[model samples]
Target: MHLSDHDLRQFDDAYLQTLTSAQARALLGKALADLKAARERLGQNPSNSSRPPSTRLPWEGVGGQETPAGEPEVPAVSGDVAAVADTPGAAAEPEETADPRPRRQGSRRPLSGAPPGRRPGTPGHSRTQHLPVDAEQSHRPTCCAGCGQALTDAHASRAHNARYEIELIQPGVGATGLLLHQTKHTYYECACDCGHWTQAQPGRAQAEVEWTVALTEWHLAGPLLVAFICALSQRMRLSRARVREFLSDWLGLELSTATINQCLHEAGRAVAPVVEAELYAAVRNVELRYADETSWKEHGRLRWLWVFTCATATLFVVGKRSVEVVRQVLGETFNGWLMSDGFWAYRDLDQRLRCLAHLIRKAQALEDGLEPAAQRFGIEILTVIATVMAAVYDARGAPPPAGALRARHAPMLNALLNECLRQRDAPHEKTRALARELLNDWDTFWVVLDHPELPLTNNEAERALRHWVIARRIGMGTRTAQGTRAFAHLASVIETCRKRAVSPWPYLAEVVRQRRQGLQAPPLPSPAS
Candidate 1:
């Protein structure tokens, strides 16, 4: 029954008009009330006897059947309908409900069939067959035994069964022994010249070397010496005896502190080249470098372990704290910027970037509890310095526009320098005077602003060197200059790998393996070989 376009339009209009604003609104309100009642009932008795009212509209009356008017008639239900319906305060049923939890599936059923015997295509089944011998069948020979004639069944029943047993012992401090048993039976043939014998070897035994390689590799990797032993004895505040006891109980290996030290030294030597190569590559690539030196004891004498680092790498050099040592580590011809605090040794380095953060700390201490005059002066100068440094950082990776930067910051810079000079010449306290002397290097300090990428603080380098400081406190510093160098090399590589998100152990292992196999000399920078 396809309706004409005109008829379809008229039908839609009539249907829409039937649901007039007020009538439609009333229907909705009644639906909401019904939904609320249903929800209250469900809440009171979740396992209710009432068949839930259908959300679907009822079918229009067909033929002569009269249609129920206004609301749809609900069907009767059995059991606890009244219990569910008694709750009036329950909330309305939601138009849409989502299950809050996931449902679990039932366990799988077992496969059902006859227990299978060896069949042609079945797994672990073979077609080849062997027949078993029975004592009664074997005794049924019908000849005489002396002349190799068949013997009577009654004479063949005299053969006796044989059995053997052996004991296996596990040798250790707490030894245990296991008994192994074997049984065999042999039949004597009527003919004396021929008899069949069968014997089974002991169950397959494991080769002694099965675990040897893995154990050797584990020890060679220095897990005990480097990680457990050294970390416990040196870093964890454990006594030497306690450390030894832990090794014996946990690893079944006993060692003195001196032996642990020797293993560490050997491991460091084995991995030194890989570390050195990484440090050299990192230093060569970074454009800005931070360097600092801290006191270290070597062979009972005072020395220094100088650390240098950038975004990509960390390198350490051990020597006496002299300007010459710094100059040597950082080649004279090298032209990149070096960040450090106001150490006079670094003063001669043409491209030094003084740490303004250190100066700020000193100024902050001086202005504490002071009059506005000093405080104001200190604040203004620090603010100007910070602003200029920020501008430099903002312009990093590119040259700042000619007069656009310095011209904008010039007035603030002049004002701060003039105030600093005035404070320096004034009759002030000793601390303030010393601060003034430090600030007098404003020309060199503020030069950092001209280079956008160079940081105003040497914090990066100091942070890179922090681990050494902690290690020195823990282990009382390296014992010799060579030991110091080894520490620097290994630490440099390990930290560099960490920064690059590479695992150091695998890299070190490969490098050591290649060196040991004599497949390469100096495992550092071989591109092809």
Candidate 2:
């Protein structure tokens, strides 16, 4: 769709609403042409569009049947094409039956799929059964729970079902002291017997300083240690002072803030290497890596809290928002698709999917503003992208959009970009600034479509950063350099455990347990391990 210079000039915010009747006709003509072109180009879908996955309609695939991948079950048609084909005089573009591909559908499921919900040979894995049982009581129903029928002897006279019952133990602090005796033997050099004596390995133990490490003193067992850490961080979101008060009041134990700080420091030290290794392993080989950064205050200095995440792990780093930090996290050569916003640090990276949500939000700002030209541009951009996304949803995981449809959409996209470039020097600051920004990072807007696995948005990384953002806003950011490092490590471990479906408390408690006993910290948990 082409706009004449006169038509384009009418896009000026002040000129549009006051246009004469003749100018109105010209503008309408241009808009109609653009809209007509837009109707032909359909490639957007929730998978490829700026529209989020959460916004997907539940009825998308209502009438559709599940077909095996790469083999869409198309209904065979038995009818006439020649009549309509011949009647269309222009180019004889064929008229055919509706696309036989199954329509996209959505559903509400607590879990994504309907699995057996238990493994083979698994015995009674319900929630009540999962926790340790303290007591069990059996009671025959004296009266029906619903109808109040008297049936104290119903089981004796009629069909009855036996049900197992489990009662949970009450919540109470259990403190246990552990005495771990470590013994090492050293052998002397070989003599006439001709057997050489090997030296014993050195003990990793050190004096149990008051603040040696979290759970490092062995004064607390695994359950208590895990409970304490969970109370301090995840469950209660409590400060050290609060944790002290909680233990003092409930558990009848006194813990100083300094002691609590030492515990966290020790926990951080024990878990740092293991967590870092797992983070790298988890994110390194993933199909898509989402990266994001936000403001972090470290020792009263403004810094960046960066998060790199994949499906199986999340790694956090707090430091300067610089290329060096990205390099440190991602290494020099990453071949996987990296999804991120259009940050200058991410520029020139290979295999990157720019966050469409960021661009769409910018367009939304324009859509809401008063400038007619800018508003129209923003609205059209949103429409075209949403249209393309709808088409993508219908693709049902088919290969990328074909050349013909891509070609049709190409001009429409070019027109928008051209319009942006044309208005780069517009008197309207918003229009000019947006145009300049789009022009500056133009390539990122469309590069990911070639790789179906690359995400269209960096929402994963953004969501990963959200928890810390809330915490930081509440003045929970680190106050010391060491504390900052510890926080990043702990956050990384917590997030990675969640991603891997392992309980952080159990794994962390084990790490601390090993550390306190002069043993090495355990590796990341797996079934085989």
Which candidate achieves the best lDDT against the true structure? 2
TM-score of each: 0.51, 0.59
Q: What global local distance difference test value does model 1 have?
A: 0.55
Candidate 2 weakest ten by summed lDDT: 183-192
Angstrom error at residue 512, model 1: 4.0
lDDT of 2 by residue, 1-529 (tens): 5676675665766877798889879878767756643542232334333444443444344322234568655543323454554556746555856654543355223334445567778696322313233333333334433444444332333222222221112243684542222212221211112222222122244644433344334332232354355437543467778877876676544456675676677677767768667677677777778999988997678999999998778999899989998888887887777888777888757777777777777676666555578778778778866765554454446665555445656777788788877889986555677678778777666654334345667889988877777778665588887777777888888877777777677677677667765777788776222
Scored by CA lDDT, what does every candidate get?
0.55, 0.63
Q: List candidate 2 segments past 4 Å from native.
A: 1-227, 400-405, 527-529
Q: State in Å the error of residue 494, model 1.
A: 1.3
